[model samples]
Target: STGGGLADYIPFIIFGAVALIMTAVIIEVQQAVRKIPIQSAQRTVGLRQVQSRASFLPLRVNHAGVIPIIFAISVMFLPTIVANYFNAAPVDTWYYKAAHWIQGNFAPDTTNLPMAITYNVLYFVFTFAFTYFYTAITFEVHDVADNLKRYSSFIPGIRPGRPTEDYLAAVMNRVTFAGACFLGFITVILPIATAKISGIPHNQMYLGGTAILIVVGVALDTMKQLQTQLVMRQYRGFIT
Candidate 1:
């Protein structure tokens, strides 16, 4: 008999429990939105006056999504990939030593204390930075502000022009700070957890939080799109 029993399954159980907990956290943060209230100015129509209406602009909490994760991983792998290409060089050469050092220190699967620390720290910093960078690139505060202003809408107390842009920029920075930290944590956490709990090396752990995030994000987005389509169909049918 192989004598496999509950003891052998403990690691799997712990991993499962951790996965479930993280799934909840990701779902909550993923769906979280900041709703900024706005008011539209009343305007005169051709023959009548239109009343102002209140609305909201919804900003997602996790704005960058998996893009930051992908960017961080790609960056983290680049140095290692380059370093490995120099493996054919003679061991006594400085270039070879430099390449070896680079691979040893920067490789994500590293276990050495100093090396692992360096890898995780840099990986985390890159993830955090990229989250903000990607978010800024995709969601232009100036554009949003201008659109709101053009539509005769103002975010409640905020002024219509440059002030509105400043307010939006401030809000976005604060929101992005939270999201950046979360993204960094999610990207680095599985490797850390694997190193600590499962006795499996970081490189051996193929299914990480990134995979889960992508899967869950895609599923949620698909559901939302499907729901929107159904609602649109319902409205069209009603109009018909």
Candidate 2:
């Protein structure tokens, strides 16, 4: 029989590459935000007309991008552990049956419709939950509000203090919801769809979905920074 093609190992290669690229992307994304002078109506003598120098906020979309892939892949493989445990159990025992069921149904590679559906549902739920959890841990609404207040930069139509905090929180809430849902959908469906469309096996797609998002997010952010640099140089954006 002909040996399996190298493409058969594409998933693992993709995973490895993504892991490295994501680490680099996250660090770069973090560096993108920096404080710049926003000229104020009033300023200190000898000091530039701009307000006090402060650190600008950098928002990284890839904050938890790799996290979801890691979790999903881990959960998908958990049934393998269950399988090993069950294989050692006494034959015909309930535990054995339960383990077999889990292995067969929850294994990410199988084409069993029921198991696939169940896995997708669980994946989506966990991804959604983790997305919010991570966002909450990372995004500091109070701190952002404080910084804005210190700089006297209020959200348009929002009063400084509690109102601004509330406004920022609301904006984050909406963004978190949209972003979480998008990630959840991609995590659940992209792999399955890629497998079907490309004639590749299903499990291969799990990490691919997450990789695409991270790469795209980093690329967009880099473009934004480059555009900012270009504008500073009195040149138009690359696209227009």
lDDT of 2 by residue, 1-240 (tens): 234677766656655665456545445543433222232234555755655443334444434555665666677677778687778898789888888777777755667988877778888888887877777787788987887777666555567789877876776666667666767756766566556555656654445656666666677678889998878777544445
Model 1: per-residue Cα lDDT over 43-121, one tens digit each: 8879899999998898888999999989988988898798888999999999899999887767666567788788888
Clashes of each: 0, 0
In candidate 1, the residue pairs with backbone N, CA or C atoms under 3 Å apart (3 or more residues apart, or in different chains) clash, namely none
TM-score for each predicted model, relative to the true structure = 0.92, 0.64
Using TM-score as the measure, the top candidate is 1
Model 2 TM-score is: 0.64
Best by lDDT: 1
Q: What is the lDDT of candidate 2?
A: 0.65
In model 2, where do residues sit more than 4 Å from their true spots?
A: 1-63, 204-207, 213-240
